[model samples]
Target chain A: MEPVTTIHGRAYPFGQKNVDTDVIIPSHWLKTITREGLGRGAFETLRADPDNLFDSVEFAGSPILVAGDNFGCGSSREHAAWALLDLGIRAVIAPSFSDIFSGNAFKNGILTVVLPQAAIDRLIEVAQSQPIHIDLDSQTVTTPFQDRFAFDIDPFRKTCLLNGLDEVGLTLAQGDAIGAFEDTVRVERPFLAVGVGS
Target chain B: MATTHPRTLYQKIWDAHVVERRDDGTCLIYIDRHLVHEVTSPQAFEALRLAGRTVRRPDLTLAVPDHNLPTTARRDAAGQRIAIADRESAQQLAALERNAPAFGIRYIGDADAEQGIVHVVGPEQGFSLPGATIVCGDSHTACHGGLGALAFGIGTSEVEHVLATQTLLLKQSKSMEVRVEGDLGPGVTAKDLVLHITGVLGAAGGTGYVIEYTGAAIRALSIEGRLTVSNMAIEHGARAGLIAPDDTTVAYVKGRPYAPKGADWDKAVAWWRSLATDPGAVYDKVVVIDAAAIVPSVTWGTSPEDVVPITGVVPAPDSFADASKRDAAAKSLAYMGLTAGQAMASVEIQNVFIGSCTNSRIEDLRAAAAVLKGRHKAPHVKWAIVVPGSGLVKAMAEAEGLDRVFVDAGFEWREPGCSACLGMNPDKVPAGERCASTSNRNFVGRQGPGARTHLVSPAMAAAAAVAGHLTDVRDMI
Candidate 1:
């Protein structure tokens, strides 16, 4: 897994609030048992619109997305995260995100940046024409229009993103603590102890 | 002195999250938002006392008395609640109101505009957000995870966990990715897509895994559509389902009453962004799906996997391949009165219902209303009701004249709440009657014991209502 710190990727802008997963990957696509071909189904409904963001030649192949408020608001389907990833989107800029979608996105290395709606509007305006810079170390999304917006990230998640760490990695980082706690707890609460053969 | 030990995210989040832990492990979980309804809370609060515990923090928890709230009240002499068909259950509701304030859990008793399904209210209210862990006694607890929180449905024992500890000790599972890519054709919905996935993966395909749904097709859906997809994860036997945070996510939460504002808002968004999965991150398993092949789907039996698109044929019992599978299939079809080679859309219904946490929002109602407008319910269809998921939904729906649309079509415009989803109240299917519904689960007694259910989307339900049979929503479109 590659840790994301700074990115210089092309950007695509979608200006809408509460864009749901059904719009992204729709319910009909849930039949298959694999993840390889879903990119085609991404934004199936939006794709129906000839002028949809994903279909626009200007933003074709762009890996960064800037969106309006309340993005990814519906179900906890992980496919929403995957569709974006497969479409070559490595990062998303929005005013907000669905809680479960964010976790799923992080696990897949999609950086979801929450900026002010004003910053997002600005980015959306610039994304259609120019590239944007996202610096994880500096925590900003800068456009050529002299606009630089700062954002915040939790230290733990920041560390995880910079190191490509997931839940298991976070646990592993505190491996000694877990091990020591288990050992001591076992000795103290003998009845709770069991053979951990592994 | 007690040691100042580090609380795990489970502990830290739970503790700081808790306004207070009540008797035993029951803490408020500092409900940044609480969604409640008529049926479950009465018993839950009753359990609190039977166990001698009081609600620790009312501000953190909110309640809505739905389920039993009468939809026909508007037609009544006073537009007040129609007396419960069962007086004893009415007594239980009385106790809920009397006890809510004593325990400090906010209760939007019947007639309160705030009441609705506990599952739908949190995200709607902006209380559910990324990185938070939410617990609701309802199996749809997983629904709140749509907001990027570590949310899950818990049993009664687990509800008590929140009532006391405001935290849960969950063993992390091997991560799995279920990716959906491609463009779904017109007439397809998230509901059809999830049902299709479960059909192939089998009902238990996701056993013991935390599924991370990724792909272009998934990221493109609306919040309601995503909920429909993940809501069925439990049907696949997955522990939970999740999506990534992005612009669409943030935009949904902004302007909601409780979302952070100013500098704090900036902090929350930044932290949320960093939580996305790492690129090239390894998972225990990964499953990718073709979005283009999906069609409007419907379930044929009790299990969610027993499904095919509206245009597809009924599956033969033998097609199950195993005797048990075949027998189960046979029994479900026998109960449903379906035959192999029978087109799924041709099935008939005695009634049609369009409401539930699964598909009873403004959009859902609107979709159904669009179809129901300028049409009348089929004579063979005895009942067609549109129940909003919450009181707020009812108001919004009524504001849009959806109620009139239903009434004009020979359908009942019922009050907001889970009227027939679980049959915990009087609104339910009569014995031996088959109805097209828009709720989750079709187990033998899911809607009501011996009450046959055929799940469909709201638009499909509306279409079926007009046709007096199960029909493809696309046909109407």
Candidate 2:
């Protein structure tokens, strides 16, 4: 994953609430063996309208998306995250997000910023013509109109996004701890280890 | 000077699985079971290949193809493999078929009798165990929590992480108790109860919380009913939902293929019995529900929360107090092509689907079968199909002659897979058609492009098929 520090760009002011993963990429596009080129399928249903914000000249290739509450509410498909990244969405500002979607976004280096609905409403209005700026270090989202909103994120996830940590490598480095846990479990709960690694 | 800590069922499982805890409250938790399906795993395998990481515990992981496979048939009359018509879907399924064996993990193939939806296959095979931490790439993996497992969905990246490390880095979720007391009224099923709960909780109500369902009504439900309720935890925005194991859960797990035997079973049951929440255990949130208030329910809009009792009428957007909810309701009304004030039973449907991870067990099949036993689908109901969750479920249903009941009712008794639920295959409801479906999620275009789905229970779907519209199963019963 690439280190994410700051994102500044036009935002697609799509404020549809309860936007599920089925709408993010849809099941039809899930057939790909790889993650590339999913941008074409991202919000395919909404983009069917040629005048939709995603395809509008003013917001084309925007790095930020301003959305309504409960954004990414269904399905744990990482393709939703990949599709956002493919569409150049580096950060999403919403009143709230589904837990799985937020986690997926964080893992893929996409910032999910939650603010009050009042702030989200203001951002959507300002996002129409202005470029929004987000700074991970400051944990803030700001518009050129002096509108600024602070956000909260998990401290561990914040460090990971800023440093582009490799989670697998980090976990693998603790093989000794993992092995020790497994040894203890082998004795304490032998049934769990049954038929495993045979 | 010290008192013993009272723990929730979730806390018990979480503490048992922690391999390491970080200063920031993030813990590396061991995953005891990993369920894999075709749609979300190809990239995970590729990542493993790129990282040169072999699976940490191949035996703990199980793979099966379901999402994109056609439910029509996989073999000819002469027993030859029939090629999947959709090239992309075939390739995706083939990728899993290759990846699972290559990675030394068990793969239940398309023709295997054990094959079915990953969630259904897990508990049926006893791969999902009590107090185990299970993760799958699909959100409905919460289904395993019905069996007392701490299971939740993961994205593809986490899929790779679990495959390579057999552990997930995570922070513990706030615990919630959804207590449903009193007996469910006649014709009220677990599906109806869950649908009613979704309406009460809204789509994001359980976000960031692991809910433990309890109380009298929940205890009265059978294991299959419990599975139906837990399967929709994701729909309520909870990653995992659990019902602590009791004799019902133990009986369901016993004699299954992977269940421990003899002394191990006795010991496992002892631990499982101890997994229930302790007296005075505190929760971050509590929701008390009256089971008697539930009825045969159906979704009226594109969101699962847009639900109402079968006797109710479609709600106007103005009925919602929240501005965002009002706007969403209006949009959902538009997309669903439903009119406010219309009777829910009067809404005509051209299709009926009686299967999904949400409700496709033998019990579910019998429920639908009982409704359709002496009836046939209405002529105007162009298509009605019952796809079992797994091949085992199908075989079990056939043993009880439920397939004959469905077939005699003019409904197709199809092979098991996630058919018509997400519409990645040929069983999709045609565009512009309304379907009474017993699947999770009524999202736009979920069954197919321009397809409007009204979520209901198996019996309700069967009743709808016979009436050619959405109707209360209570009437039929």
Candidate 3:
């Protein structure tokens, strides 16, 4: 995981709503064991159209994405996040997001920004022409058009992202307490620990 | 005198799972059971390997290959391994088989008697227990919550986290109580209840809340019926749904293979009984639905909320006051190739799939069998398939002759493993074809690209197969 504070770059301005994980990366693409090189399959159905926004030259290598409400609405597949990451998307701006998808994106170092529909509309227009700036420290998204929008994120998640602390790292930080709890369980409820490992 | 707050079932489970609470409000909660399937476990294993971390509690984890196995046996040369038609599906399943043993996790794979959809096998094998914290990589993990567990879905990253630590960092969600009062009329089923609830609450209605289903209607349902209701909770944007355990749940759990025996069993039951929500517990939101008002319903648009009774007609997009909903309805209608104001019963369907985590249990099979017996599928119905929830379910249904009833009625009685649910396996509703499905989601292309899915109950789906179109199961009954 990488620490993310500010992501300033061109963004894909596709503002489609209710964009489910199935559409983000279809089930067929999930058959692979490895998560690498999924960008090719990311938005494959949409990219089939020559005029699709994802394949447009203007948004090529964009580090940000602006989407509509209820983004990533279906499925708990982290492949959606992996696909976006592989496609060079570092942040996503939407009015709202599916909680599971948002959690996955946060763990994978992708920033999900929630703003009002008006702010999103402005960002979509600005993203089509120029770059958008996202400053996590300031909790604001800005464009050269002087448009600025503030957002809110859980303080815990913001700290984890800023510190590059993945779940493994965070859990390991509380190693002593977890070990003690395991010891107590071994004594108090030995049955819970049994019947494991076939 | 100190006063203790009355806690809902969700709050009790959440409070019990908390290992440590941080000042920032995120808590590291213990996970008692972690269910894994072929589709989502591969990357998580890879992540574990990269981090050089072994599973911390392999005993608490159960691995099954469900999403990829062929429902119908396929043979190649030696016939040692069931032939998987898709290369990626085969590779993914093989990866899980290889990985599970190395991690010391219990792996049920490839026609094994215990093998089935992860959600089905969890409860079937007694791995899902009351007062436990369960997590799976599949959204239908909520199915286990019917047994009074706090079960929900996680992603690959969280899967890896659970593998390494048997815990997850999460913020507690608000709680909602969906109270279904009164008894369901004859011909009404749990599938109908969930569909009706989804219609009342829309796709995003339960967002940021864990739902607890209560009231006379819920308590009257059989254990299997309760599972079906909880299984579709994710369809309405809830991460999890639960029904507190009672005598019905106790009866279902006792004597199961993994269930505790002797003194341990007594202790387990006592603890499970205590897990019920305390009386007078308050919820963030309360929704009361009259079970008598619910009829056999089906989805018309892509969203599950875009539904009506089988006797109803497709709604015009313009009927919606919200601009976005109207736009979505229009797009869904176009994609589904449905006309506004057309009778739902008149809409013909070529494929009928009566299996999924949501409605493939023994009770669901029996319900469809009752409708299919002494009848035949309509000539125009291209494929009517019945897949059981698990291999054990298949064996049990066969023992009851439910499979024969379906087969005699012109429906294909296939093996288990989420067949035709998401259409990732060989069973798929072809593009441009419409299907009467008992699965939960009605999203566009959920069955297949350009495939239209009409969500219904198992009996309703059976009725459709016989009528060659969407028909009211009440009429057939």
Candidate 4:
């Protein structure tokens, strides 16, 4: 995972709540095991439209996306996040996101920004043709046209992304603590110490 | 020192289980069961390899190959026909077999008698039970919550989490109580009951909460019916849905292959009984529904909430306050060739599929077969197929002559597989075709790329098969 510090990109304003993963990459694209070919299928239906966001020359390589409430609902397919990343999405601005999808985006180093519905509606307006700026340090999203969209994110996921660390990375960072806990548990509850998580 | 008031069930469960908390407030909670399938495991395994890791607990994790596997027997429904159509992806099943044991996870491959949808296989193998946390790489993981457990789906990285650490750090969820009271009508099924709940409470009604279903109506449903109710909680935006385990639950688990035997079984039963919420357990929210009021249901538009009773009419555009919603409804109605205010039962369907984890059990088959006993499927319809959930279900249906009635009714009695639920296999709707399905979702393109799906009851799907259009099952009854 790359340490994504700053994101400067255009926004694709998709105004729909509860955008499920099934629509992100259909089952047909799931047949292959490789991740390379999926970008072509990212938002495949939206891409199929001649008037789609990707078709607009100005937003073709945009790194930010502005979506409506409840984005990324349904299913546990991380390919939905993978497809967005493959298409160069660095951050997603939505009113809310499905819990599992948010966890997935964080792990894959794709930033998920949650704003109020009003902030989201404003971002949708500013995202068209205007370049959006996202700073992890300030935890704020702003557009070049004087539009500022401040959002909240878990402090933990932010640190992990800033340092490019995931669950494994976090575990290794706690190696000393884990080792100590194992030793203590051996004396406290011998039956569980040998296979703690098992 | 006096402790404060007792915690709610969700809070109590969340508090006792924190493994660790990081700088960002993310807590790593222990996971009990890790379920997987062919569709998502390959990538997670690759991630493990890239990190130079091995599976942490092989016994805790289980895998089944179902999503893209063949429903028919190898020889009769083998690659000959599918090869001509989907030749490139025909070896998807073979790939799963090659990959599973290499990862050292237990794999139940094609035609394994005990194999079915990962969600279905979990309970049958005693992997899903009371007071446990289970994670699967499928949205329907919430289905297992019916057995008084906390279970929900996770993404690929989370899949990797359990594969390596068998734990997930999740934010705690608020609790909600949705109590559906009253008795179900003779023709109503569990599928109808769930669809009706989503209809009244919009799709996102249960957002950010763990919905615990209670009341006489819910308690009366069979373990299978309760499973169906919790299965679609994902459709309602609930993190997980649970029903307290009771005697019915104990009976369902008594003699299964993975269930404990004799003294162990008594111990398991006692533990399961102790897991239920004590009398007067407080809840964060509650909603009551009338079961008798809910008939066989069918969606009329693009979303799950665009539903009406089988005998009711489609809502006119003016019936809604939001213009955009009304416009979307009108567009979906046009695509469905249904007129405003037209009886929803009059809308015709070209396909009727009875499968998916929601309605692919032996009871669902028995219910549908009882309806299709003497009549053939309407000749105008292009397809009507009955795909059983597992081999055992298929064998049972055959033994009871249910398969014959489905076949004799001009419906294709296909093999056991996921079938058209997600349209991963050869079974799917032709582009732009309309289908009446007993599957959980009615989202646009869920059945296929351009296919339209109407979520309905298995009995309603049967009646539609016999009439060639959506109609109330009560009319046949």
Best candidate, TM-score? 3
Give the per-residue lDDT of model 3 (tens digit) for B255-302.
887776787777777777877888989899999999999999999999
Measured over the true interface residues after superposition, the C-alpha RMSD of each candidate is: 19.4, 2.0, 2.2, 5.5
The candidates, ranked best first by DockQ, are 2, 3, 4, 1
- RMSD score of candidate 2 (Å): 6.5
DockQ of every candidate structure: 0.01, 0.37, 0.36, 0.15
The list of candidate 4 runs beyond 4 A from truth reads A1-30, A36-106, A109-164, A172-198, B1-16, B21-25, B76-95
Residue B143 of model 4, lDDT score? 91
lDDT of 4 by residue, A49-167 (tens): 89887768878878888888888899877788888888888899888899978877888889999889898888887876577899997888877778776777788788998888887
Question: Candidate 1 lDDT, tens digit per residue, A1-198?
Answer: 468988776798777888888887886564333343677888898898898778787887788988887888888766677688778888889999888778768866789999988888888888878899998988988888778999987776778899886543443344454445445534532211221111
Q: After superposition, how far is residue B26 of candidate 4 from its true place, in Å?
A: 3.8
Q: How many residue pairs clash in each candidate?
A: 116, 0, 1, 1
What's the distance in Å from true for residue B19, model 1? 15
> Which pairs clash in the backbone of model 4?
A156-B24
Tens-place lDDT digits, model 1, residues B10-106: 2333333433344545443333334444444544554456446554334445555555555556235776656666564565566667766666666
Candidate 2 CAPRI level: acceptable
Which one wins on lDDT? Answer: 2
Which one wins on DockQ? Answer: 2
Candidate 3: which stretches are off by over 4 Å?
A: A1-28, A39-164, A183-198, B1-3, B74-79
Provide the lowest-lDDT 10-residue window in model 4 chain A: A189-198
DockQ of model 3, rounded to 2 decimals: 0.36
lDDT (tens digit, per residue) of candidate 2 on B251-354: 99999898888887888899999999999999999999999888899999998988899999999999989999899999988988899999999999999999
TM-score of 1: 0.64
